[model samples]
Target chain A: MSNTLEISNLSKNYGDFQLKDVSFTLPTGYIMGLIGPNGAGKTTVIKTIMNLVMKDKGEVQLFGKDHRDFEIEAKKRIGFVYDTPNYYEHLSLKRLKNVIAPFYDRWDENIFMDLVGRFEIPLNKPLKKFSKGMAMKSSIALALSHHAEFIVMDEPTSGLDPVVRREMLDFLRNLMEDEKKSILFSSHITTDIEQVADYITFMHKGKVVFSKTKDAVREQYALVKGGNELINEATKQHFVAVRTGAYGFEGLTDDVSQTKKILSNSAIYEKATLEDIMFFNNIKTKAEG
Target chain B: MVQLILKDFRVHALLVVICLAALFAASTLYIALVLLSGNGFKTELMLYTLITILSSSAVSLLFFIQDEMFKTDAVFVSLPVSRKQLVWSKYISSIVLLLLAFTAHFFGFQLGVVINNGVGFEGAVVYEGPLLWCMLLLAVVAFKSYAFPLYFKFGMATGGMVFSVFQLLVVIAFLYSLQFETWTDQINAVVVWAEQRSLGGLFGMLLCLVVLLTSGSMPLSAQLFKNKNLGT
Candidate 1:
């Protein structure tokens, strides 16, 4: 299958932090979770893709077109949801729709109204009166109204209650039932990603730690538990990061097979979740510094 | 482009109404003062000139303030619209608002005149001529030429502060220049020359300058805004 999104050697500098040669790909018909800690350049990457924040250097392709060169055409096929929903808060949803609907060639008023009704968003009330969940639902309704083939959301689940977030995830899953659309969702909440993402791209400190299928990640990465004495200078290199307690030690390893071979059945291996991978990678980075 | 311009007007309808009302009030007060104080054509002209420039600038600045308040640049950028189109829309919207402000001031002036006539005040002098209209247009366009480039590049908050400082420096320089005999002589010579020129020639020159400044600033603002980062 062709890739829905491709980013290569993406770099941006903000003096205090920098995105260093970030690379990732999301195949068509699959949800790619861009999981990273706060301030880990996830939002910056999304903004750069949307050309909201101009990239210092690199290339981003959307549906086989250079994002910058064919911005209008590329954006026509993509729906964007900002973390804070950057809309005029003094206008009602109905008024806001008039301003936005004309810009998209394929906007469907019927679909928009349907979503609004289902989401229970008020058409007459100004958006400033909307609760956070209602505001997010409004954004989603707008994004989906134009028959967008690709959806890009930056921290859409942040600041949401668990029930609202679950509803959002369910809506996203329902959207993918078409088998022609793709989603790139960025979030610091790993469980949200774990529940919806087919592929996971993990970032730490503005760098891509890994980008792979979720099943591969689960199979290759493991949390090893054993005595503290089991970890030595030679064995430590096998672990992405190691944490020790008085009774025992647990470490995350990317190469589980090699680690198992080295430890020789001395340690028990457990499946590493996305959070575990991120946490261990962060520890490794901090230790290296 | 049209949609974006309309969006600005429709989204900020209340703010626009407030601004127009304020302009009308100011215009009425100025006209009443000109008639009651027996001010000459010169004083009336100066007061109207200030109103013309301020009205256009105030309207343009309000658009920027509203954009910043809502962080709507991000929304615009994400749409299918190009950056150049966005810039063009802003310029066009400012011109439209300039015309609207002029209309408000004109109606306000007429109301003042009617009220004065009702009170048996014959002191009111109306200067309804092509020269006045052309001068107003030049003032509005020239202020926009000065304001938009800075606003597009540095955004409203920072650009506004810089513009204020620049204006202060210009005023200080003008006052300082009056102390020198040569500068005062040159200024007087230019004014005398302008007065000596034919009305048609003066009007054509101001129109040419206005066109030149506007066209030049359009491309500069578009270029600066093209690569700008719309970060919160």
Candidate 2:
């Protein structure tokens, strides 16, 4: 399968914070989740891909061409939804369409009007008067109106209530059902990523702590819980991280089958969620290096 | 590009209306003062006309350039429009708006003068020659001092103060030049030379406007926006 995006050795540095060498690829017809904690440089990574922020060192290729070379035509095929709606405050939905429609060759007014109706966005009200949820929906509608192949969202679900978040995710999933589109979204809400992502890339402290297929992340890592005695030096070496408590201990491991073979009689294995894997991986990676 | 220009005008519609009204009112007031003074319309009327043209051009330039640099610029950059198209749209729109404002102010001044001083004042004074020179100087100054710096810095509030100071210095230099002993003779000599040359002054001014806009704004805007950190 062709890759929609290929990032290699991407790095950016602020005087105090730095994004170390990061590499990843999102294949076509897949949803890649950029999972990370706050200040993990998730937004920075997205911005660099969109060329909203300059990269210190690295290359980003979108659809087999360097991003800089693609220029306006390349940008036409990509949709970007920033965390904050940065549109002019005085413009209404209709006004915004008038401003944005003429630029894109594939802008579908019918699709835009449909989204406005479906999302219940008021067409006449100024955007500054929109509720947070309404503003987010409007942004999504705008993104969808353009016939873009690659959609990148930054913290799209942040500050949203459960119902609104679900609706937004459902809309995105439906869009992905066509199989010709790809999405790269960054979020701290692991459940949202867990629900739609085919691939997961976990970043922490400006580095990729772990990256794998969603099923692989679930299959490779297991939460082993048992008595404190079960957490021994030999077993610890096999596990990524261990949490000890008064009653028992739980740990994460990538080689779940191997760890199970060694500690067969002592620990009980449980399925790991993406969040659990990230937590343990972050702690373990920090501890080891 | 037309759509972008229309959108920009819509965004600043209120400011445009206010600018038009102010120009109309100022022109009427100046003409009334000139007529009611009872002395034959003096040559200073041309100076007043020059001041009005330059001031209006500066204000309009500031407003449009500021909006392009700071307020609506981020969205413009992210759109499918190329940076060149965006820059050209602003440049074209500013010139159009400036022309419209200048025409309205000019006619309004003429109407007021005609109403108060009768048809006799219509051909009594020759202001067109000076007015054209004033506009050319204003265009060059506006592009260099306002548009170019605003494009480079990407913030009107930050760049505007420096532009204002520079304009003040230019004005001070012009005033200082008038202190020379032969200033009046020099002015007459240049005017005579220009008249004999026929459209040389206007051509020189047009060339300066073109050079300032092409070499100053287009490249500055493209370069600054090409590598700018838009997320900021």
Candidate 3:
């Protein structure tokens, strides 16, 4: 599949933190989940894509065009939903929509109205009074209404309740049925990523740990559970992260088949969930530090 | 761009009405005083007109403060338009609003003369007022030119403070310049020049200066906004 976005060697520095050589691609018709902890530079990456923040070194090509060279045109095709969505909060949704509609060449009032209807948003209420979910819904409505080919959201599900998050994930899934839309969303909620993402880009402390297909991820990492005594120092090295609970021991292994041989039927190997994969990666990074 | 300007007008509709009313009240006072005393209201008109224009120009500062308060610049930057377009829209809308204020104040002065004096001011005097009005607009434009570059560099609050300081400095400089003999000569020379010139020439010169200062400021604001690391 052709890529909708391609970021190569992306980097940004902000005194105390630096995003080092991050890169990723979201293929057409796929949802790429950017999973990272708080302050992992996910928002920075999203901002860089939107050119809201300056990148020290990188190439971000959207729809095969350099983002800076064709900044306006590239942005025309981008649907950006910021984490907080702080617009002109004093303006009502209808008024804000009018304010924003003129800038986009393909802005469809009908599509915008439809999205508002789908979200059941009150058109006349200013966004300042909106609940967090409502604010996110409004931002999504704005992004989706412009016939944007690529939708990039920064931590959109971070503070949402599970029900709203599920609804959001389902809505994104429905969007992907169109086969031309692509989504790149950041979330710490692994379940949300598992529910909708075809690909995962895991980041930690301003660096991309891995970018892989979800299926490949499932096949790559295995959760091995066995007795505490079964865990040796030599065997622990094979696991990305290890936990020795009173009941038993559970650890994650990227080399699942080799680990299965090393453990030799003493431990049970199960398919690793995205949550497990993310958790283990985070633990592994912390352990190394 | 129209949408944005319209938004500004909508947001400040009440303020605009209040300002226009104040202008009328101030103009009526000046006109009534001059007509009853049988002397020109030039000094009084200059003071009141300066106050009206300054207040109107100050209202434009709310646009920046509002944008900053809500962090709406973040949303704007995320929009599918170039930063240059955004900068141009703001500059044009602000100047348009200043013009609107100038126009409203002119009408208010005219209306005030008719209402308070029941007889119009002298043909030459009333026609000559636009020259001073042009200068008022130039002052407001100069204020904006000084304020906006700082606004793009810093956020609204600091820029507002800086602009206030700029005004204070202008006042202080004027006070200091009064102590100089050359400054008194220049003031007399300007008064003589004003008496010598036609209203058209005075207005044309002030308008040209206003346009020059305002136009010059646009590129500075645009460049600052372009280089700005607008945070999300």
- For DockQ, the strongest prediction is 1
Who is ahead in TM-score, 1 or 3? 1
The runs of at least 3 residues in candidate 1 whose Cα sits more than 4 Å from the true structure, single-residue gaps closed, are B37-45, B118-126, B129-131, B166-215
CAPRI level of candidate 1: medium
Interface DockQ per candidate: 0.69, 0.46, 0.54
Model 2: residue B54 alpha-carbon error in angstroms: 6.1
Query: Chain A only: TM-score of every candidate?
Result: 0.98, 0.96, 0.96
Please provide, for model 2 over B15-76, each residue's C-alpha lDDT reduced to its tens digit, 9 standing for 90 to 100: 77887777777877777777777565545454564576566666557445656444456566
Q: Can you write out model 2's per-residue Cα lDDT over A1-289, one digit (the tens) per residue?
A: 9988999999998877788888999999889999998888898888788777788999999988887777677688888776756557778878877767787889999999999999999998998898878888988888778888999888999989899999999998999987879999999999999999999999988999777799988898898899998777887999889989999998898898899898896788899987887788778767878
Local distance difference test, per candidate?
0.83, 0.76, 0.78
Query: Over the stretch A1-289, how does candidate 3's per-residue lDDT look in tens digits?
Result: 6999999999988999999999988898899999988888988888888888889998999888888889888888889887756756777888777777787889988999888998999999978999888899999998888899899998898788888888888899999888889999988888889889999998989999889999988898999999998898999989999988999998999999889888899999999987887788888888888
lDDT of 1 by residue, B108-208 (tens): 77676665663123222323323444455555667566778898988888988888787667557755765665442553465446557867667778778
What would the per-residue lDDT of candidate 1 be over residues A14-39, giving only the tens digit for each residue?
99999999999999999999998888
Which candidate leads in TM-score? 1
Off by over 4 Å in 3: B1-7, B10-50, B118-128, B178-216
TM-scores for the candidates: 0.90, 0.87, 0.88
